[model samples]
Target: MGGSTSASPCSSYQPSPSTVPFQRPPSRFKDINKNHVRLDLNSMVSTLVSDLGSVDINLKKQRSGLLKKHRDSQYRLVELQLVVRFPCFTMTGTPPSLFTMPPRRRANSVRCGKATQVSGETHRVTEKNGNDSLDICRVLNGMWQTSGGWDRIDRDDAVEAMLRYADAGLSTFDMADHYGPAEDLYGIFINRVRQERPPEYLEKVRGLTKWVPPPVKMTSSFVRDSVNVSRKRMDVASLDMLQFHWWDYANTGYLDALKHLTDLKEGKIKTVALTNFDTERLQIILENEIPVVSNQVQHSIVDMRSQQKMAELCQLTGVKLITYGTVMGGLLSEKFLDTNLNIPFAGPPLNTPSLQKYKRMVDAWGGWSLFQALLQTLKGIATKHGVSIATRCR
Candidate 1:
């Protein structure tokens, strides 16, 4: 970040507003050609190529074990400042800075039209308008990094980290209703930014919260109460966005829930959205005229299932995709490039069931060897582009 470059907005490349129509390949997600839905996914290999408990044991150990050799000393694998890394990664062709081009604006990263990057692919999601948002760094500032398993996290430090990310113009946070104290932490973060940063800076940070209630015959009151609870927890009079996730697809009550969400959106409770919703469900929702602006899901190069019909539906419906697991829990980094990922769960603490769940997704996509090959290819691409594998291509 200290590297200096020409201090001017890059005019080198402008995305053809037409590129917004970029459609993903069909049959990329669930098309089964004799069970050969190989995505040729190119990123972290160690993640997909391992046993479970041991790879995770080192990462999941207590703090004492990581520091002390005491037999009883538990490794505080969770406490260590864990990082996501990839091997054989190098991307020199990237621009000196980052400017994401997203279709929405978040609340915390109030900076609109500001250039930001992870591996330096220039994108500007926020233009002069306040409605447009920036692409959240594919690798978000995971709160689970702090609050996931720790007995307690320092509130001030947590807030400071959030501010640092916001100050740097990285918005688009992915959180859920059940994450430990997540709503409260995000609320404090927003309040702190409002109190500390300039008014203009307050407009860029956008925090997206989720509502994963059990599938029920949702009532208007029920949905509104959920939205109201999040609003109170986030300390905001109006929510930037509220995504709903349903555990059961069979229950018809989901529609009722959405109707209430739509009402709340009209009432300024939130910018309505969905999470972990499959293409089929999304299509049904759209057909029913539910106005959703985005879909949060387990998307990554290795997991290209979304590229099939899901991405197309989004393109048609004007909803964008906020992808998590893009880096496969940091398994797409330099450290595991050529290494045999036969270890137990050597990965870091991934808070949501997503970490464990997605691992299964990877296995279904392809066995370990195929994943390794994919990472090698992405590594080659990253090296040519000039950025860290995790950032450049992760």
Candidate 2:
């Protein structure tokens, strides 16, 4: 997905981690006369594991039903590889610490350890025409990793990771025009799927690509040409979703651009959407009768500016939200918890574009100290619920 940060007034302090011990209260202090409740951590963990297993089974059943329906309708067969992987576990349902240490690479594999076994659910969004819809994974595999500063991503490894995610049911991917080689990488991965997997599984994969164009005259040919380029790069005859982004709303040309994109829906595009548009411009687009299914925006626990107005307007207009920065470029995880956000780095600096972008958001949200407190509270909740801090943040 594309990257952007929100600046809004927010709290500067958050509750610290619940340090109150998990032990039962003393008999003298207990309210025996009234009803009492107690929680057992072990039992909660067991239930969580059971629920996850049930969800996995249900997802498989759903996939099977969908595939059958597609075949009955004579739609193109898109086969999905069903692979099972084991989940990581710890005795206490939490990691050893809240600090992310530097990664230690293995000689044979780019990934440090076994892949985690979590799958995203799928949802279908109907287009404005209501004649067709797109099924997308709730958790989109973002391709911003290809952007500079994270690390040198080997092309082969990146394609392998895409396959791994697809096998795990994360079939929807989000990429953009500016993200380096992201579209080309998707083309390679899809070609691999076509060559190796069953034809039925091909329809399960969806790529939601973006068009971040410079503010200029948005002629019919210009819009068609840009979208055709993305389609060629991704090796798709028709794009699943084409999200248009404009840097400066002052130009007043975005309307013409979106109109032209909407005109192309008859051919190369399936659904047209928006990215990083505020409520005001979104209103303008809607008033112009543009058929937008969703708006990609920066939304997380810390930054809630969207909820204040954008969400309400979307509710009224029936426009859904595709959120990014939910984990703040991994800063919301335990790795950054309790760290000195102000001091210079003892090791390598925060080099990735995502880290640099979200660090500024952390500072604007209330600096490092407040964020640490939030992380601590999140850790406590995650432990009680038998999930990782990263999962809780998401």
TM-score of candidate 1 versus the correct structure, residues matched by position: 0.64
Best by lDDT: 2
Please identify model 2 stretches exceeding 4 Å from their true place.
1-132, 346-349
* Lowest lDDT block of 10, candidate 1: 13-22
TM-score of each: 0.64, 0.69
Residue pairs with clashing backbones, model 2: 77-200, 78-200, 78-201, 78-202, 78-203, 79-200, 79-201, 79-202, 80-201, 100-335
Q: How well does model 1 score by local distance difference test? A: 0.51
Candidate 1 error regions (>4 Å): 1-147, 150-152, 343-358
Backbone clashes, each candidate:
54, 10
Cα RMSD of all models vs. native, in order, equals: 16.9, 21.1
With candidate 2 superimposed using the best TM-score fit, by how many Å does residue 145's alpha carbon deviate from the native?
A: 1.2
